[model samples]
Target: MKALWVVGDIHGAYDKVRALLLRAGLIDFGGQWTGGDAHLVFLGDYVDRGPNGVGVIRLIRGLEGQARSAGGQVSALLGNHEVMFLAALVFKQGDPHDRLGFREYWLENGGQPRDADQIEPAELGWLAERPAMLRVGDWLLVHADSMVYLKMGGTIDDVNASVRAVLAHANPDDWGCS
Candidate 1:
């Protein structure tokens, strides 16, 4: 098995991440993960805080495909920021507009409002379907700290089921089994 390169919350700042990766020799001048092609595990929070949230997302999405093509895989776990932006982007019935100020939040955190129109529906849908947690060997990758024990189905499918339940509810207090 190739070495697993687990990354933490980026909070955008694509240029910084790129520079660090380059300095560390993880990626090349062409922006490819050429250092041993390790299994890259992204620990979420790709958007929000810092500039270029959309660029960060696109870069990771592009890397996901490239990593897979290179016989390694990229595990992109869903963070709370992703959930917040997704809720703001998609129509949520009664008060969808109330959640529209995520752009402001992004700005406060050093990000600019992304052109939602430029993002394909299918890609957004794929992002919406991302799992909240990923178990890599004995380690667990999650966005926010768990409030209580989450009763996932003892498998990847089970974890996704639990995450879907939480996302469907859209209540911060009701996340995990407390």
Candidate 2:
């Protein structure tokens, strides 16, 4: 809760994200969590559109544990790009529910199959488990600047629950368009 740092949409740019974190004293050059009791919040879109999406994920996930051990916290929120990536993994391809094909859609949106191929199970679970929204003090945080969160639920908890349910059910209609 103290010294909160929020970052938005890395889009697989590992160098930039890591640089910011290092510069902020959140992590060291070795990518260790150096900010004791400071919180780092990643606003998702960790994959797709660029190389090293998986690397970004690995950094965030690794930092999460390290920071927690050091009395700090790290949180990553789900973005539309993450949604597209997951949908691509699940449905693969073929337009279902009158939307673009999942795999093809992701590719068109700058998805990298290499990232998908190298993604570990823990990373996959971590990505899928990310919240779509959060509140830190007076600041309301969400990955995308969109009104779609409103339709999910009136409350943050409700909206996150709705998202989790959709993901759990793997409904093409619910997650197809991001």
Candidate 3:
């Protein structure tokens, strides 16, 4: 059987992630993919908490391409933090309610200001396209382990489509509801 590797809740710990991947021989010291033909899945929460969220995302995105070229696969699931980050970026002016805006909410929840500032349109589009859940063989991968995904769809395709639709919209309320 092919080997499968899983990582979760990176929280912007780029250095640690790099070190771990190096130690595991998944990447070289130069931070390039070395895990040829290996299946690696990131279970989300790629941003906030630590630092270098942008770096982390960039690394993973690069690795995805490299891994594909090497006959390996690198995939990511969408975590709540990703949603919070996107919400903040898309709705920088804050929500309509007097409570708290997306930016404020993200910051309050361990979001780094630099990460928010460094995000580019491509990165935002990439993050928005991530699926809320994924299935590999018998494994049903989800970020939150919540039943809320059922509301998205009965099938994985449906859920991913629904999430894509939600992300494509500009309304903060739509994002909040998702």
Candidate 4:
């Protein structure tokens, strides 16, 4: 059986994340994936809070390719922070009636300036395209412990589809509903 690992709510704690992975023997001193053929799943919140959100993203993105080349798999789920960040980027000007705009909301919620400043288009696209939920064997993985996903759909595939659709439109209401 292939080794399986799951990590969640990184919240920009790059050092802590690195230490944890190192302790788990998943990565080496050089921060390279050493777990050949292992399946790793990140449960999101890769950005915001602490510092080095961009660094964390860079690490994960790199690890994804490295893992794949080693016959391993790296999967990331969409978290609320990602949605908020994307919203902030897409609607930086703020809404008419709302006191706080997307950027303000994101900042208030621990958004790191460097992360937003250095965000690449490809990174944004990757975050926006992540699935809201996933299922592996008998395990069902979701970022939040709320019924909000039900608003998307009954099945995992449906929920992912709905989330993709909402993200495609980049409409606040659609994102809010999802």
Candidate 5:
């Protein structure tokens, strides 16, 4: 069997996340991908609630490319927090989905202002493009442990396609869920 690793709710804390990966033998001190072809799955919430959210993002984004080049896979799923982050970035206010206002919504939901300010265009795109769920062998990999995915679609591809559509829309009102 292949080496499979699952990580959940980073919530910033780059040093801690890095330490976890390091201890897992997935990365080295220099922050290079050392896991060979092992697959690593990050179950979202990569931002908010802690310091160094942007640093955590950079590390994961960097690792995505490195892992791919090394014939490994890095599956970073989208949690509700990421949805809030994207919504906060694109819309300043007046989102029907967020009565508190998009920016305010994010803040109330553990968003870090510094992290929001430091986000790059590429990073935003990367975050938005993340899958909501995935499957590895018998593992039904999803960020949220909820039945909401069942309403999204019948299969993994169907669910992803549905989420991609939701994410692709310019207006926040079009997003049925956040």
Candidate 6:
């Protein structure tokens, strides 16, 4: 990797992400990430707090593939919003208008829904699979600070797996509330 482009919390700003990639000289007009062979590490928060959450997700997913094909790697980490969205998705199957509180939370925090209908089962499935953090070389990347948890591991995968396992159970606050 020539250079690693660490993107901050996008918060569903699809256009801003697009512009940064383009300005970085990576990716042509085709939405491909290609330049200086930089490894693109999106620091999560790709959804919620913007008008194009769905578009943002699709764009990043697409660019990850494209970047891989172009000899660069795109790693997207999980943020709190991602976790919230997943929680809402899981809750939605049991209740249609579920998470009114969650949606209001997003709105209060500056987010917009992409569509009420025409849901993409694939994207939702993907979100469920995202990890809590990403590790690259000696750097630890997470949507929010995880310094308190790093003592347990030297690798991002290790820490993420541990955190995710904790989040799997109910009453998530019990995990790191100490």
Each model's number of backbone clashes?
Answer: 0, 0, 0, 0, 0, 4
lDDT of 6 by residue, 2-107 (tens): 7888887787687887887888887677786666357888777777776677887898888888878777887877777776665554444335444245444444
Clashing pairs in 2: none
- Taken over the whole model, the C-alpha lDDT of each candidate is 0.66, 0.86, 0.88, 0.84, 0.87, 0.67
TM-score ranking, best first: 3, 2, 4, 5, 6, 1
Best by TM-score: 3
Q: Given candidate 4, what's the lDDT at residue 111?
A: 87
Which segments of model 6 are wrong by more than 4 Å?
93-107, 115-119, 146-155, 166-178
Worst 10-residue lDDT window, candidate 3 = 91-100
Q: What is the alpha-carbon lDDT for the whole of candidate 1?
A: 0.66
Whole-structure CA lDDT of model 6: 0.67
User: Which of candidates 3 and 4 reaches a greater TM-score?
Assistant: 3
Clashing pairs in 3: none
Q: Is candidate 2 or candidate 5 better by TM-score?
A: 2
- Write one digit per residue (lDDT tens) for candidate 4, span 46-88: 9998788777888898889989999988889998998888877
Quote the RMSD, in angstroms, for model 3.
Answer: 1.6
Q: Tell me the spans in candidate 4 whose CA falls farther than 4 Å from its real position.
A: 94-100
Tens-digit lDDT track for model 3 on 1-178? 5678999999999999999999999999999999999989998899999889999999999999999999999998898999888888777753463134778888899999899889888998899999988888899888876766778889999998988888788776677776
In candidate 5, how many Å is residue 175 off?
2.5
Model 2 over residues 120-146: C-alpha lDDT tens digits?
Answer: 887777788889989988988898777
Whole-model lDDT, model 3: 0.88
**Clash count (model 6, backbone only):** 4
Q: Per-candidate TM vs. native?
A: 0.75, 0.93, 0.94, 0.92, 0.92, 0.77
Report the lDDT of model 1 for residue 13.
Answer: 80
